[model samples]
Target: MDSMKNKIKLLAVTHHDKKNINPIRPEASQIIGLHRSGEVDVLVLCNPGSILIPYFEKEGIEVLTDPLEKKLSISTVLNIRKLIKNRDVDVLHLFNNIACSNGATAAIGTRCKVIAYRGQTGNVSRWDPSCYLVMLHPRLNKIICVAKAVENDLRKYLWGDKSRATTVYKGHDQSWYQNESADLSDLPIHDDSFKISLVANLRPRKGLHVLMDALALMPEGINIDVLLVGADSNNEKIKEMIQRSTIPKRVHAMGYREDAPEVAAASDVIILPTTKREGLCRAVLEANSYGVPAIVSDTGGNAELVENGISGIVVEPGNPKELADAIVQLYKDRAQCKEFGVNAKRRAVTKFNVEQGVDATIKIYKELTK
Candidate 1:
């Protein structure tokens, strides 16, 4: 083991809905980006349900799938073990808790280091029992939480051992925003009307209800059209919420789109009314990258991104009145919006680009190897 090459081969495995895989999370993109840049060798093992196989294969990264049913499958575990042994993988990075639990168990004989990545660190009740259970494994060296808020929550609710934790902020495409020649006509909305866009899934955690309530309370003089971009996942509650809303005409529930920056560009102000405990949200950075001001709720990393009244507005999570007030304030003051937008973009360019994130992650990996 001491004489082994320093070159790292990382295995990122996720079990999400197939259609939702590509358009949804930034994990796959991050891994592929790193692999393409020759930073590391990534072998993606997604749920058999995901179509990410072709995408990963296209990028020249080895892709594998497991027929792991909802319940634990012994075959799946064995197959993963075989893959790890064949590739001589240096680290096994699990994107979700289920995979982490399985990977921990699989690494028992091989003594391979395991790292788990958590996107959100909510309350104890929100945590998967598998994550807590995986901590029992000695091979599991670290858990990467996307934000400091999540790291705090993990120490408070789940794991008290802070030594095994690390925080890594998700990066965005900074150059896309800086490239003035990039075209945005491909985005769904190109109209000149006052546009307010929400780039989140139509899930309860995202606080779409709060956003709707705020829209209802918006000032009478403000004429704003909203584009709520996200997948429904057949959630009846969200469906009913969208159906029951009176602002259907004003709000276009255009489902998920890969070109999120394009949608951000078509908007005047981006809104993220998340009530759930989020880690570092990429949407905020992406929104800020396009020089679009945001009115985010005071949840997770929202406060960290929005510089109060300077770059953007941060209101109480799930507070419709406060959200409405902030939105109206920005609406009435276009100059303030422009000022905040400029600052937001500057912040994104300087701090949250993909290259910076990759550099930080590689540094961590190198340190871990040493």
Candidate 2:
């Protein structure tokens, strides 16, 4: 075992911009935890004035801003190389595909071990040269998948090595779920209406349209209301769909609520009927932490987080009928919902807590550094 005195000097890189007030990704929280625990001397490399900068700085962690481009730019590579050389970075932790490629290139001649964090289950196009460069890079020593499902997907690729890659579920700060006095007074909800919440970015892959389709197919006399809480990605398409739908009055498009935990608390059941697989569904985890059972599609890490018919129901992806059936079933049986909620909360607290994630990640860092 490495001595605590010889902490690893880690450089965590992310391509995410500072668009929102708070850090949206799990990497930020993990870095903050690592720094505070004295497990790693952490420095974050991100875009200029990135939303992450303020958050990292508030925690007294150092941040470096660089224009990390998606394409293979010489300047980006050289800058990263310089940072690695000057800082004596023991490990380069990359959070995105582009950053992984650039960091791998930069670490070519250095002793720094490259660790790529794969958080999405989307398969890389075989024709994309950059994907090959990033995934199969000789400099990359470890691939940290956010879920077992993601790791399985990576193994299908030519460059993915089962021996080198491992799953590490992203953890959440339990504090985010500790909103006992959460008030959803702002949302439109009647005392008699059953609320179903879908908290994700309003995008095609998130399967908002599929969820809406399920709602349209919902059996009559269900008396259900849906709260769509996320940033609008497809303009007013969702709104327009709601307006023209059979239950327009029952659906509320609450765009990008910062109080997501509170929103989950207010809802009876949470759902994520995504068509595409995710690295892991953080929304589902958050809802589970708040003791809200979810109905997620059997895609990506959704099934991993939600034990089908146990913690929550797992319906087939892109199937409106199945989604609708699951929703209706859960709605009809309140006891099952309560039981699932209890199990979900137990799993979230016991297995998916931020402390557990940090400990796993720190162990990986120690293994690499040693």
Candidate 3:
């Protein structure tokens, strides 16, 4: 073990403006935890006057609000280069594509090891010059993919040095599991109702239409309620689909909630019927931590998180009938659902805890720095 005298000084950069919540928050929290534990000295670089500034400042983590514009700004690069030189940063970790590109460029000729966190499974075309340049950037020492599925896609499409890519599952703090569930009594759902939650941003690829179709096909006697917890980007389209469905009354569109973990705790089971591959579903992991089983589509790393017929059920992607049947099966067999929930919680605590993810990342940092 390295002594406190040999601690690493790391800087994290995110492209997200803090008006709305970003996926990078959880990782930021983990980094803050590491800072608190005296494992590393950390600083965050984000947009000027971002909402996240005060939030991190309260916890004593340093924040640099250098306004990074849409296009690569030379001024921003120079600012970052100056900060790196002054702080003697050992590693520079970037959260998004823009930050990765810009930070890698700024870290050129410096001792700072650049590590990029990739959380999407989308293919990068060689035709896209920016994607091509970022993938082949020589200054990039490590690429931390959020899932094996994402790493596979990155290697297949981006043509990078495959050895540099490593899979590091995103982790959730244990406090999410310890917190009391939110009071959802105001909703139309009854105590006896089988509550199913879909906690993802409203997107076409999320397959909410497929879920609506499945709900429409359910038998008349099924006592179930669906909670949609996310920002409705395609509000009109989802409203139209819900309006056309037979079970419109049973579905509640509870737009983005701050108490997502509490919502998951109150749910009997979680569902993600995404048509496209996910890097790794943080929602599913959160649900699992709450001892809620999930019925996820067999795409990307969904299958990696869920054990079919054990922790949770994995169904064919975009297949409403299969999804409906799986829902019905779990709803009918409450005992099985409970069993899966227990198994899911066990797996989550042991395999996907925040500390585990932080430790893995620290190992990588030490490796690169050494």
Candidate 4:
């Protein structure tokens, strides 16, 4: 461990503006731990309007505000370079595609080690010039992957030294998930029905339509309902699909609730049917932490969090029949659902502990600083 006599200086840039900060809470645990370690002096650069400013400032870390919108902004690069020179920063940690590109460019000719974060799969292509500026950039000292699957995808296109990419899951603690479930009485869902949740922003890749397809295929009187709890869940596509589905009344689309976790926690099981490019699906992690089994599509790292027939079920993406069958399997056997929930909760505790992620991060920082 580095002594108080010498502390590593860390400068991080990220795009948190207009994005929900709740998803970044796990990263907050890592950041706060690094600053409080007495071995790292941390400074963050984010958008002026970002809620992350107040959250980090509350913990006494310095935060600078800049829109940081463009990838090749000379002013942004020079501004970052100035901060590095003034503070003698030892490392630059980037949390977004633009940040990774700009931060790496800004650190040019400097001794500062660059660390870029990769949260999703795909998009790192050798043919793409922007890819060279982002993940394929040679200036990056390290790429912190959110999952092993992300690292695997990265190595397929990244240039020399595959070891430069590392897996460091943005882990969570069960304590953070231990909260009172939201009272769902207002919803049309019955008390005795087996509740299911699919918590994601209704992006086309999220496969909300596929989920609706599965609901339509469900046999009559399945006694199960789905809770759609994310932004745009009530979008036109979803609305049209719900109207066509047999279980239209059973599907309650609660668009973007602040109490999403509480609502999801109230479910017997959760589903993540996203088609592709997922990186450790935070929804699945959240559900597992909530002690609710997840039935996730086998895309990206969804399977990493679930063991088939153990913690939860893993079905192929866009396969409504398989998904419907899995849901029915869990619903028909409450004992099996309870068993899977126990395993899922245990898996979250054993594999996704936030302190372990922090420890690995600090170790990496120490190595680079040393």
Measured by lDDT, the strongest candidate is 4
Q: What tens-digit string does per-residue lDDT give for candidate 1 at 46-129? A: 887776676778888877788545334577678778888988877788777678767766776884567877677564542455
Residue 145, candidate 4: alpha-carbon lDDT = 92
What are the Cα lDDT values of the candidates? Answer: 0.72, 0.81, 0.82, 0.85
User: What's the candidate order when arranged by decreasing TM-score?
Assistant: 4, 3, 2, 1
- Cα RMSD, model 1: 4.2
* Candidate 2: residue pairs that collide: 18-51
Residue-by-residue lDDT tens digits, candidate 4, 115-228 = 999988886679889887889988998999988888888889877899888998787867778788888988888769999998756577888777888888888878888898
Q: Give the TM-score of candidate 3.
A: 0.91
Residue 13's lDDT in candidate 2: 86
Q: Kindly report which residue stretches of model 1 are placed more than 4 angstroms away from their true locations once superposed.
A: 1-4, 16-25, 36-39, 48-51, 68-71, 123-129, 133-139, 158-160, 175-193, 200-202, 231-249, 255-260
Clashes of each: 0, 1, 0, 0
lDDT of 2 by residue, 198-220 (tens): 87565688887788788888888
Which model scores highest in TM-score? 4
Query: Model 3, 314: alpha-carbon shift in Å?
Result: 0.8
Candidate 2 segments exceeding 4 Å error: 1-5, 19-25, 180-188, 200-202, 231-236, 243-245
Give per-residue lDDT, candidate 2, residue 64: 88
Decoy 4 TM-score against native: 0.95
lDDT of 2: 0.81
TM-score for each prediction? 0.82, 0.90, 0.91, 0.95
Q: Which ten residues in a row have the lowest lDDT in candidate 2?
A: 17-26
